[model samples]
Target: MLQGDSSAEGTQPPDIEWVFCESIVDAFPLLEEEDVAGIWMSRTSLPQTSEIRGMMQSGLMLRDMPEGVALLDADLRVIWANHRLLQWAGRPSGTPLGMTFYELLHNPEIMGPDFCPFHTALATGDESSSTLHSMDNQYFQVHAAPVRSAESPRNLIVTVGEITDEILQQQKLAAIHQAGRELADLRPNEIFMMEVDDRIDLLKDNIQHYLSDLLNFEVIEIRVLEQTTGDLIPLLSVGIDEEASDRRLSAHPRENGITGYVAASGVSYVCHDVQNDPLFIPGVADARSSLTVPLVLHDQVLGTINVESPDVAAFSDSDLQFLEIFARDIAFALNTLELLVAQKANTAQQSCDAIHSAVALPVDAILNDAVHVMEGYIGHSPEVMDRLRRILQNSRDIKRTI
Candidate 1:
């Protein structure tokens, strides 16, 4: 059979001639001819060409896609995958085919709100998604959807994209918030047992731990604003030079460095180049970048928290945001501590007043009785009179002490 119309007498010679062949053996001779453009397969011999064409269309659509894409059979075996998907799996084309999807990924742990995404998609004929944490510390967001076709085998189309950075950021944010909450956390026993200075030390230790371990901040300095004296009193310092920590900063935008400026303005500041920044006073040795944020609560600037790094432009906008949030929590914790201290002082004063009230009248009555007895006994018995005088003196002293 010819590929084009057979009406040779009526139609002008077709631009291209068609030659039909029964098999590859028949097409071999035609391929030897210089003018033969290409060989074509018969529709009957290649019945699955339409299906392959559909697959090719899908592959073409997905080839340049940013995310990883794969086709899986009912057995969860990979039947086909795009270049992106193969790259992610660290496999060359055709190697991953017939391998179970999990096996190809080296059995990534499914971190899921939907654990059985493939099963769910196939069973419900809907899309399902799950997160996968691979052995290589990479995180992937995987989505699966049933590929519905009446003539084709049951299959699933799965897409994956790396979400490692986003996941790690979320984890860090959560940890920072938890650490912030724990900064001022004290048990009732601790509150009663620990002195004000001891509580302050605990808070400092907690801040240092979180900043260094959780936030990965190396050089940190925290100062509380002494509202009365306008002094930024150093509350905590780590990896900061002693001289700088004790440099006596105040709420001045111009003269007192970045910490002071942030405290004064109640705004966050990022110093990309500490050497060139006018307001930056050296805190950490070899420091190249710095971030400072005001410890604010209820529209009031409580203090400032500053962090320094050795890499230029080390701090990003996200770092600034995280620091600011933590600073607010620090301010709140500090305020809570102050309130507790004030309440303790007030309680102690009340206790003293109660004791004075309870003892005052009794002591006054003793004084009155002692003096009266002393007056009556002075001329009668010298020893007894002396004893009475001592009693009267002791009662007056007791009243004064109370």
Candidate 2:
């Protein structure tokens, strides 16, 4: 170690120096729109999106708002919204007059049509999103109720968001301030966040037990959806209990129930009670409640997210939506990890489209070729070959294309 001045002799090493400064995620403390809208909601501290300058010049109006409301109208126009809604909408400086809400999103073409809440209200008379997106990289929580007026029965009284960048930034500041405590909680929980890479690696550096303890659950399992089976096979599990630690679960593609169902089906579920619920798996359904959320990247389910609780009916629709948001975060990291791993192998992901007709090669030959191509796959010993042959036979038996 380099000798420091005598005054610095007792200072800790840089590795242990600790990051006291705020990071972006921590820079903004996060709040959900739903939180401040409860029965006991405050009557003040609400700012309409239109009131915020630069966001509503295009004849856009923020109206029909409650003290703490946030909402938009059809055509994705910014009608009346809150500061918190502003954050969820990701509107910079409250003035996004010229820009459409969908314009801020990466896949507006698809998410936009679904964001047609006005149409939903007209149809159902009441509507709320189990999930939503304000922009390409951001998510939001939304609530809408029919606002009946003599003029228009289909009018809506929508209270939008309880989250904003300012709130997030404040949260970030608070998190930075609480770094010392957060560091303590980081133990035991192996937190891994997916960034712009493909290779999967553990977020081993920040395992402070204190953070893990505060996380409510001891373990979090992240499994990738195998394209072949549509199963949420283990890519990683953090703070696993004695029962499931260091173990890999078999992935079910297309056919695997629950885990497979969610991954392949892209459905989000909130298990208010796992042990008592019919959908809960038999043995592992010990938790009071659990959430099975889909991890999607580029509109494809890359994996499933599992969060548990000891209280029955523990998971809520809001919680499930939050898990989905987290899943997207995980998906981003996972995609990066996959890209990194694929890059190391210098090979493209094998698409099984041509199994039957490619080059007139017999299915058996194709099986051998695939077995060879898969990086971690073992040799074509009699047992393994027998398995591959059986799979091919099974497919042929059902007339299923590989």
Candidate 3:
């Protein structure tokens, strides 16, 4: 303990201290006449580290924050981080001190090499906001604002809120709507199967270009069951090559793979970790995760749609749900086309049968009566009778030719 004596002019303050003071001048009623400036003063010490931490936390209002909040120095190193921020970083004990924000987040690619949002805010004193995405498809909405205090230098206050669920929902809705538009272009007729095949090829191409581009999925395959054989056949594939991988269009029995299981059971299956999944099939090389959704309608399994990623737990529950719903739309479209095609084929066969019956009966009777009349007029010469017999035989065989 030390006294803050007015007479001690040259004494320097210690490097750090937790100071507490109370004014007692008003309490000194007995010393009203005497000068109070000469009164003695004393200082008592408290735990400096805990006291400082408490003051910092209280000033920043960091307790119980839902969004991640952090006070960053000019170098982007973490000076102070709130409880929520620490928890998001998996540092509940307040570790990760003095580390740069991007370093701690392990995602430097979210911003460019020369661009740091926190540094820009501190330098320009202007607030900035942007969206960032992690490799695991999690999204964060980031806001960086400049904070200035008379007692301290300028720092950046960075706040981050997770927006993965909201953004994904919007994206899924948009994608489903777009797919609906594309599928509406199909015209069902005698050539409906041909058009369906062509449209599926186009759909697969767009998926490889845009759908796989956004989701970062390495593999996409669509399968449709052959109505005759009841076997699943690959309609289109983006990543898996039939020749190179030695994979065929048809999936093996349920004991052979995940797709088969989904197809047979008429349900969706997700393997967040392929290495650990007992039913996971090793069709794609180095596949760490997979999602298989069956195309089903009226309690009948049509086929399966599959997607694969190289990272474990790369897909979320929303992904599986969205895909399962999308598969329903596809299944309905295919089933409708198949029914139309079958009806058209049946109608064409009925028309051909009607034509054959209408032409064969009258023609056969005319030929037989003409042959009998010719035999009576020509007196049944050996050569003429043979010709008449041959004409009758040919008339009877006309139906087989038709």
Candidate 4:
């Protein structure tokens, strides 16, 4: 939409002609591109100033727009702003009209250092855009377009769109995709063996360390449900001291704690303020925030992933969402390991059973048949017969012992 005062010449397409009266700029929307000629003919019928003001008051309100739009003058002072911009600046309507952009926004980080898009656009008469985040963690992508007015050579119109959720979601997806690719690249047999021998050490050196590094958590622990007792057992842990890690590895986390609660309920939990949160069960003495996400597969909770930080409110809901997604892949890995272990055990048992059956065959009967068949060849020799008899008796005794 047209927003500033400018001469009609060269402003828009020839079909959409503009007429200026009393040096005031006005823009009207066309119903159809082909009907522009008709609108020009009826320009005289356009409402007067007072009626146009009434129409603007009644219908042209910019309060409902989600984007923040601001019109700046040549001096970089705010000339006009939509309701959204006013709300963002924490100012009343028309209150920020004469304030400079830097003066209006108290956070210097918003404009950044060494470069300002609005000033650059105003100076060079070029459009520019940048992505920035506020102190409150709200993200915005600002687009500054140079608007030339008949009265001023340098004017700018800056539009800001909040993209916090979108950016966070994209980041989460990227991390999960990377993790999935890593998991897929690994051989199943290798993962199973890793689970079988020193799973904690292997996980710390590979998986858990990556997660802790990415999320910047003070502690990361993966707790799995024991097959026989259904208790959550800490199988892999990283980021804690040697003593603390030893204790965590030696014992399972209590079922009544936050980690246990998530495992029991099969849901993710986030506690930003652990000191004030009743659900917070301190894993580290200095931890002030914690997040627990259940690792589940096929409606069954296999375990939980618990992360903690020393800073209060260090983790947000977005963190929990990301962890939950990663936890799904983890659950699949754990399930695969369990299945592999079961398959290996079954194979070993079958082998043992085969050996036992082979041992149970009638060895004594086969040896006796061999001796009886040889008796005809050795008859009439008592010396050989007595020696053979003694040998047979020893064989019988061996068979009896077996």
Estimated TM-score per prediction? 0.83, 0.35, 0.53, 0.54
- The lDDT, on a scale of 0 to 1, for candidate 4 is 0.67
The per-candidate count of clashes, in order, stands at 0, 43, 0, 0
Model 2 TM-score on a 0 to 1 scale: 0.35
Question: Which lDDT tens digits does candidate 2 get at residues 12-65?
Answer: 455433222122222112223333221111123123222324344422444323
TM-score of 1: 0.83
Best by lDDT: 1
Itemize residue pairs with steric clashes in candidate 3.
Answer: none
Which model, 2 or 3, shows the larger lDDT?
3
Query: Which residue pairs come into collision in candidate 4?
Result: none
lDDT of 1 at 60: 88
Error of 4 at 287 (Å): 0.8
TM-score of 3: 0.53
Work out candidate 2's RMSD over C-alphas: 29.6
- Model 1: lDDT equals 0.84
**Per-residue accuracy of model 1 over 136-205 as CA lDDT, tens digit each:** 8999999999886653447998999999999998988998889887885765466755789988887888
Q: Can you list the residue pairs that collide in candidate 1?
A: none
Q: What ranges in model 3 sit over 4 Å off?
A: 1-59, 62-165, 189-218, 225-230, 241-254, 377-394
Q: Rank the candidates by TM-score, best first.
A: 1, 4, 3, 2
